[model samples]
Target: MRHRGGFRCKPGMKQGSVSLSPIPTRIVSNEEFNPPPQTQAQARVESLITSLADEASRRLGVTRRDFLRTTGGMAAALLAMNAVFGRFFDVLDIEAVEAAAFAERQGDPYFIFDVQTHYVGAHYDPADAETKRKGAVTKQALLGLRRRVREAGLNPKLGGDKGTIDDLSWENFIKEVFLDSETAVGLISTPPGPYPQEAVVPPKEMAHIRDEINRVAGSQRMLAHGLATPQLGRADLDFMEMQAGTLRVDAWKCYTGSPPKGVEHGWWMDDEKLAYPMLEKAKKLGVPRVCVHKGLPLGPVEDYNHPRDLIKAAKDFPDIAFLVYHSGFKGAASVEETFTKTGEIPWTSEFCRMKRAEPGIRNIYMELGSTFGQLVITHPLICAHLLGQIIDAFGADHVLWGTDSIWYGTPQWQIEAFRRFQIPDQLIEKHRYRPLTRELKAQIFGLNAARVFGVDVHAKRNEIPKDYVSRIRMTYLEEGPKPSHRLYGWVVG
Candidate 1:
């Protein structure tokens, strides 16, 4: 089609020519072409739009079908874009001084609570290649070897490899990240691998694992999420109570995977056959909360960790206060629908792949442990918006901060990104992400965790020092160790 103002015409077009603007023709005399001052504003806008478009295009490669299917109308797409872009500009324009001011308002001391963290034990390191070979070949003999590999950190390539265990040592892990960063408290969970199908270890070994966890946690503001398996005999339960009641371990961590016969393993949280009894026992034990793993199945376990099962359990045991890990990722549609229909339950944005099925849903709280960095950089706006939505849905007090660290490598980057996220003052005032008041930050940072863990956060508030915010920011942004993953080549440096 031909356009007005001497624009070229295309063949076989019947419509009148559309008016077109002319391109500038002045030749640049300088080494680089500099836009006019007036155009600088336009250029900035254009640059931001272009960057946003490029990101959308990249994500579209993976989610085009979903986008097209969900956004049946162009208007809906535009609305989504407007919401996303508006937030992007807001974040980009955040002044460092404002962030510092926000940090200082809390007396520069915020109670730190890492709701999700992992610990590697001595068994994580294999003594030699013989042990490694034995672990690779024999089932029973491999239990200790696998634990060693987990402690060493699994090579993600090996389907189970995480990273080097040396990188995960409690001494190094805490010192390099938490200790120096002003971490006041942490919730530590057992690494997933130590539980074997063959149940090679006696009940004593399971108790020993709890002891090791406590030892590593030390007296420095720390709480434990005791790992449990039905495979443990009565003696094991006795030992666990001793650890929990005496040591004051906060919660019980349960895996929803099916175990092989004779091997002691945690019961699947969703398995009605096992869940009711387990819940009863947990309730009887006076355990206030249970952290259930409800996401991707690890290793040979299949169909055991579905969110639907967790939902049923939640409905059945309303008093249990179940913390569904991954927040029923596969059932996000149902979650969204549930939130839309009934304004209860909290959700997290890290599970946006599933949550996007419905926008503005609430009632599920999100933990930002494993889903930081990669998602934050790639889908900054959407992730922030989702976080906002979660805040709105659950209230900032309900949202918890976690770093599936150790497995992902220290919580530094995750913490940094959250601290750096530039949520606008207007949005904050309007409760856009459910109003992140100072009280809410305290709740998310420590109060909620303490309540869930049945600990007294107020008493330990003094344990959190001033300058912690600046310390976290500096540690994460300036002094943090770089991620070894090659995928994030640009941002690491």
Candidate 2:
């Protein structure tokens, strides 16, 4: 059992034991620690865990919470999920599960390279202290849903009174990404605020954290992303030079929906005048790999953020790699109804179909950020279809594993879930999708990323053993892992 003790808790309340089962084990819904399950499926999953936990706790001689902390607890959850849903995950007997957990307690394999990760400064702004304080107030003013959430009595005190800003700090980010999860390498990306420099995370801070982590580890474990605002024109060009020349960025992270200073609405990637100028600049600067935030659309930016523009941009610039983050998921669509009615997923299917039509757009890659996390937990079949379609269209080589971590707490849960997830044979046969082979899974997991980033994986594997970070990880595991598996994103009631 993984004990929870590293961090302090509220008075009269213990630290809610959270798990992706750091053994990276799968499980039941964490309604107590996470947002309450709103739907019937979620509620059912919760009830199953409660019932199973009751029986298992009685048999194992432990409390329900204590049981939930154990390998057997995680096994019970995964087994319950498998029983309720189809056999999408692999679950073993309690003894076997405990043994497997023991092995993972030692170490996990498949060098995990997370391409999309985020962590903001405690104060996400540096402009004004008063402005930042008021900004927090303005932000809280918009959160009227918390009241509605309270009215519904569905996870009223969602994270148990822990302030939102406090949870998303540098210390927690490192623990959640590195100590708590098996992520060997990560790329730091951010959103555009005033300009790239004064972003939620400035390029300098991003680079500093990247350097500091690697320096402490004594190996290349982190990569920083430079911001690109094509609409800003020359200003953006200047920033790109600074990021590449001065900051020495690994790649460019752009948000098509976020307009630069001069532009009013925001421009698409195919726009020759606005967007292409930045792309041209990036090519000139020699940091050509462009990671664009496509989908998980916000309010005003919906139209511009769609992955449709990627077709032209990718075809136009074969030398430049275009990564479509979030895999163009429009919203949390009803996976069950979509499959039942049309046997199609909305945005992902459309993007994949686009690839089939063009056949020349090989440079555009589909990244699984929030897309994988939401679907795998909510609807595995839809998740299966989404993965199947993307892999079939982009090929296993072009599909990347990105959890959009820190926001989702640890990437460990997503990682564990993916390792256990399987594409059903019926769906595979119906759609002619590739059964996620270990070889293919390895490619998507980190090998493909290693190839993209030009990391010598074989050499790193050798070097990492003696690195400072490896030593840190060794001491950390010996001390035992205590993960605060709290969900840090906006929760829908």
Candidate 3:
């Protein structure tokens, strides 16, 4: 499951159990790094959204919750963000009150293929008290901040205040990814576990879920990743063979930053002896898309998580598509101010610069999972610059869409935010960066990924409407959609 700064939802918890802000105004971590405290700008945006919702809901004769669930509510949230954060979002005042205006602005849907999404499998033990406590406040305890919060007991009154495995169950995955969001196809990914074979959601289980979802939908709507740990050497290569032959995995997901149990250091992608063999095996197996976890440092060693190694690895294996998750973003809080001042994002900038020098490293693709979700709300200028820079550096054809969802609850808000997002003219003129036009967005959203993953988007889009998943979603919407606008991750209170 997506790490949420060491917190998990309590058992028996469901979406929409408590009030939620239409747009998240606070920083929420994916447990890769500690999320910074709510900034003054974010706090102001939150306050402004609250007041706007109150006034608008009263005028419309609906509750604040009901208003926040509509497209108009999403418009109001964007408007408040623009008011506080310097007009980065494209939203209008009329769109915030008028339903038709908001609907008109949100044009036809794009082929949304989320490449980085997750959930806990059946192996996740709920009754394990230690796991529960760890899931509740592991990161805080490690950082020595919130030990008493766990001891003080879970506040069941709040939505998802309890720590349990069921919160990230398979059912929730289907509901959130398929029914709640407009995700046409999702790539089921996994985090690095002590043993790749017995992961939280092992490759076998991931494949099983993939098969089940597509089987039920009667269409290809899911893809699975087989975990690869090159530090284990031969065993890992053998495991890759089984996954390729028996499991028939779509890609090989590797976490070069996370060392397996008993290993002193993490492995590198360019390591000829260790990682190259795995890459070679993957190429031989006919699954050449090697999705690696580059940014969002996994452990105490942040050096391992940097995206520098991928340049060489990708250069060596031009046939393999190295999908770099998080786009090697160092983290939101650390880079926002720096980016605003210098127009340079941390690891991502370095990555782009490296690629510019080479100019032939087109095999590497940038995947925006937690990176986009974090920056879009906290600092849209940085978000704009980020999108602009990547498109300029790598071209729109190489930037892929990924929303490390289920941690952020549903992927819909991220999708909506992306649909309306635009790089301002000033930033465009100053940096000579290309505008985020609809055609380019369509490429980044799904077209680029479709090419990488061998998905026939035209065929898939036509098939999705007739699938069982679509039928379920249609019925669910007919019953009055109650999206839990909740962020499952930990936020600074």
Candidate with top lDDT is: 3
Give the Cα error of residue 119 in candidate 2, in Å. Answer: 1.3
TM-score of each: 0.53, 0.80, 0.87
Candidate 1: tens digits of C-alpha lDDT, residues 323-429: 65544332221333445565322233333334345333433455554433333433344355456765654456556777554444445434544553555666556
CA shift of 275, model 1, Å: 1.6
TM-score of 1: 0.53
Give the per-residue lDDT of model 3 (tens digit) for 1-493.
2332122333333322123576777766554566677788888998988999999999999998899988878898989988898777778999978999998888888999999988753234454454445444423321221122234432112222342333333655776778778899999986666789866578998998898667655688899999899888899999999999999999999887777777767778999988899999999999999999888777546788898999899899999999989998888877866876777888899888888998978898999999999989887888888888778778889999999877676888899889888888998889998988899889988999899999998899788997666866776688777676756544554
Backbone clashes under 3 angstroms, per model: 24, 1, 2
Which ten residues in a row are the worst by lDDT in model 2? 1-10
Judge candidate 2 against the unseen true structure and give its global Cα lDDT, from 0 to 1: 0.69
Cα lDDT of model 1 overall? 0.43
Top model by TM-score, which number?
A: 3
